[model samples]
Target chain A: MRFTSESSADGIVTRDFTLDGIPGVLWSPAAGPSRAPLVLMGHGGGNHKHSPAMSGRAALLVRGGGFHVAVIDAPGHGDRPRTAHDEQEIAALYAARAAGRPEGPIVVRYNAHLAEQAVPEHRAVLDALQRLPEIGADGPVGYFGLNMGTAIGVPLVAADPRFTAAVFGLHWPDALAGHARRITVPVQFAMQWDDEHIPREAALALFDAFASKDKTLHANAGRHKELPRFEANDAVPFFVRHLGSAIPGASPALT
Target chain B: MRFTSESSADGIVTRDFTLDGIPGVLWSPAAGPSRAPLVLMGHGGGNHKHSPAMSGRAALLVRGGGFHVAVIDAPGHGDRPRTAHDEQEIAALYAARAAGRPEGPIVVRYNAHLAEQAVPEHRAVLDALQRLPEIGADGPVGYFGLNMGTAIGVPLVAADPRFTAAVFGLHWPDALAGHARRITVPVQFAMQWDDEHIPREAALALFDAFASKDKTLHANAGRHKELPRFEANDAVPFFVRHLGSAIPGASPALT
Candidate 1:
């Protein structure tokens, strides 16, 4: 693991790093306990590691729950180079969307392919991240992702025992439900009740597949892209509840 | 409205009152603005206005959101006298429970019948409560109820325009779907994914029937009676978001 750059603003310190050539970013409180729990976030399919969604949620986790948050670019996302296969899949996805056809089949197929490579890369990143002096190996870790993020997260959390909690949503069950069944950690899943792309039944099925005894499904009334922003705020407490806040008295007032 | 008893404890003032022979209780912040928003709550079947769920949630609204909370006993509940009809329905419900039959049908039929009477009573109480100097008629009001409360709240909120937001769940939609369609206020609904009494499809159907442009469903992994306690805490922010807190900067940190 090698850090390329660092910056600080608004009580949060941001560090950019690369491990095995995979670009990643870590966000932490500028001033707090030296060792805090870490939350690994996976960005959406077309988005990079530091997309607004990732940074926004990272801010919430860091400021609200006083936790460290990190995100890494997927194989063909962010600053990474894409293979011919990745190019073909992206073209197919765009073609489906442009033709007003179902995007689920193409997205499911493409994301599953990416997950095959991304999961092992994520484990390696975790191994490297845990070695940092500020983030010891034994601290609780959580996963937060939605849409394509959920697509990759199900299999990752299922295979990785170090993850203690997860927040996932907005994806179909086609390629993920089987892995979801293997996940036993507490989960907070979000979905669009009237999502145009994913059928409501499919979303429910994925939530139903989680083996966790302490799982909560948050279904908001909206189209696929119209997921209410408050869901992001809601996830902070879920992590606080399951992972336990490392910063003393840092429990947030949900806005 | 007439107050029969009053007590102050734990930063909340509790007042027992009656309007035209109906018994009810009101909870409010001991110190804050002279006037605050109000939330009307409904208790479950076989439960009274002062059940633990009622007082517990009242504490949340009063201390967390700085709102006044009120709940009145449905006809044949709490301090009220039961009619022969109420007695018969209670007996039938008990028999079904003892026989290990599904309780949905009995609970639905009985609660719907009770709601017919309770709706008008709730309106009258709201009118009298608003007449108080502290809770003017113009202040925003919200409704919070589950189980039989949802049964009563769906119609009550549908019929009353004064209510700006509501939290409802845990009832079959057989008798309430039509009313739910009429409610356009923002809503936060809760249900058990594995509820023994209500089918999963039934719960989803009720949530789908809501016409609110902004609504959310929180489905936890548990049976009918095992709803996590944090949901009550979650409702405070929902009310605060919609009604606008009156207690200047008194946002309670979520535990």
Candidate 2:
């Protein structure tokens, strides 16, 4: 793992890095204990590692939980180069959206393909991240993602034993239910009650598939893109509960 | 309303009061603004105003949100006298439990009957409580109740326009769907995913019936009696979000 550049603002430190050419970013409190829990975030399909959603949530984790948060560019996302298949899938997704057709099938298929490659990449990244001096090998880790992030996260979290907790939502179960069934860690899943793209039953089905004995479904009343901002603040407590904060009483109730 | 007794402990002031012939309890922050928002809570069947759930949540609202919370003994509940019909219903509910039968039907019927009587009683208590100097007539009010509370709260919140937000769940939709459809305030509903008495669909249908534009469903993986304690803490933020806190930045993220 190699950090290419580093910057600090608002008591949070942002460091850009790469491992095996997979670009990523890590956000941590500028002033806190040397070591803290780590949360791995997956950005949406069309978004990159530094997207506003990722940075905004990272700030919440950094300031609220005093946890280190990291996000890597998925294959063909962020600053990564896309293969011909990736280009074809992107075109198909755009076509579906432009034609006012349901984007579920295309997004599911495309994200599944990306997950096949991204999961191993994430595992490798985790291995390297754990080796960092500030994030020792035995600390707790969490996964937070939604939409396309959930598509990739369902499988990724299922295969990764290091992840102790996860927050996922906004995706269909067609391609993820089997993976969800294998996941036993605590989970907090979010979905839109009136989601435009995903059927309500499909969203509920995915939440039901999680084998975790401790799971929560937070369904808000809104369209797909209208997930309330407070949901981001809500995730802080979930992670803090499952993964103990390194600094006592440091977890801010960002709500 | 006339205060019968008063006491202070753990930063909360507890006051026992009565309106007409109905008994109730009020909990408030021991030190805060003279007048804060109020939350009216309904207790489950077979329980009273001072049930652990009621006092526990009252502590949260008072300390976490700087709000005054009141709970009245429902007709035939708490300190109130039970009529022969209440006795019959209680016997039926106990019989159902002993026979390993579903308690949904019996509890539903009994709670509905109680609600018919309790709704007007609660409304009168609210009117009386608002007359107090500490609880003015114009402050926002929220309703919180689960199980039997949901049964009663569904109709009560629907009929009252003074309530600006509510937290309800863990009840069947059969008798409450019509009333739920009339509530348009923000809501936070909770349900145990594995509740033995209420089917998941029934719990969900009741939540769906609410016409509130801003509503959230929190379904946790647990049995009927195993709702995680964090849910009580979760309610603090929901109330804080909808009903503005009286003391600036005094709302504690009790999570």
Candidate 3:
């Protein structure tokens, strides 16, 4: 576990770090004490730890809500080394999309492929976070992610008991629906009503499959890429309500 | 080759026989000549060769259009012997459906397991049909099926050149999507626009993935079961147009 860079602005501190080669960013209230509630954010496909949506959400969680936020680039994505297999797979995807071919199979296949590696890789990161002195040995954890995030989160969260809450995004041809029953944590799943890539029925079916007693579906009428903004408002409160009790060091700047 | 029962009524001749332990039904113009065009039909899941829908459509096709149709029991379905594996799989499926679990994975996994034998079983039936003198040595062949049919048909049709055209029903949960481009025969893919069991976008994507230049989508506003009746009208003409050039042996009685 190592911190490579740290910057502060508007009372929010952002730190760039890597744990055993997993590149990540952490955002926290600049004045918060050691050990704060942490939210791990998963980015969409073709995106990295510092994508606009990921960084912005990280900032919002820490700067406005006085919580801690963490994000890591999914394997084969930002800061992570690529391989010939990844390059060939991505080239085929671009060709399919450019030809106006069926997008579901292409995306579904890619998400499924990414998920095989992302889930275990994420667990490693979570294990690393547990060892960080700044995160507080017993800090409560939540997850925020969509698309590629859910592809990875669906399996990771189902297996990991550390997270108390999660906000899942997109519906990635629904590769992760099979794990829905195993995700016992309180969840807020969000999706666009007309996701161009995933069928609406599959999305609804995915939400219905979740066995979580406290799961809620937040659907908005928009395209896939525009969904995060609509979900950000509710996500904060859900996490804060579930994880806030442990964050006794709420930044005085926000208070 | 021996017909167990043959009945001629409603201008249709329906025959029941066992082909090497595979029970099947054949419908043809009551007075058609020995040689006629053939359209191999595939039935939905949990349905048999003589199921009301199967027999009804077979009757309608032959009676209404003077064509010959064939349907064989998919392995472990209809008259085929069910193994312990089949029973165990069915028990699990019932539990999943009863608990409202994600049907996609359960069904996809079951169908894939079945296809390991079902595809070859279907091809074996086609091989037997070739030995029957009544179907004619020169008769062109086509395929019609949906649901379990499409799951098996997608792969069989992609490899079998004996079929000149096909009408695939149900959105094959996409385990077979990888073979979409191999199906170069003219295809009339049918699906219910709001099928309770199928995602429409996946259906559209499947249609788009087909390499066949002559593929068409025959969509209707109904559920999975409601789709076949609407498609029968177009399916008959489509098959006849593609396979009829050689079936000039018109059964004078029907005309």
The recovered share of true contacts, given per candidate in order, is: 0.74, 0.74, 0.00
Model 1 local distance difference test score? 0.92
Clashing pairs in 1: none
| iRMS of candidate 2, Å | 4.5
| Global lDDT scores for all candidate models | 0.92, 0.91, 0.74
- Which tens-of-lDDT digit does each residue in B138-250 have in candidate 1? 99999999999999999999999999999999999999999999999999999999999999999999999999999999999999999998899789888988998867765
Error of 2 at B107 (Å): 0.8
| Docking class for candidate 3 | incorrect
DockQ for every model comes to 0.56, 0.55, 0.01
Residues A158-251 of candidate 3: C-alpha lDDT, one tens digit per residue: 8888888898867753578778778877787876655787776787678766777666555544466656353564466567667873346542
Error of 3 at B41 (Å): 59
Ranked by lDDT, the better of candidates 1 and 2 is 1
Candidate 2 wrong stretches, greater than 4 Å? A250-255, B250-255
Model 2 error, position B34 (Å)? 2.4
Candidate 2, residues B179-220, lDDT tens digits: the string is: 999999999999999998889999999999999999999999
| Poorest lDDT segment (10 consecutive residues) of candidate 1 chain B | B246-255
DockQ value for model 2 = 0.55
In TM-score terms, candidate 1 sits at 0.96
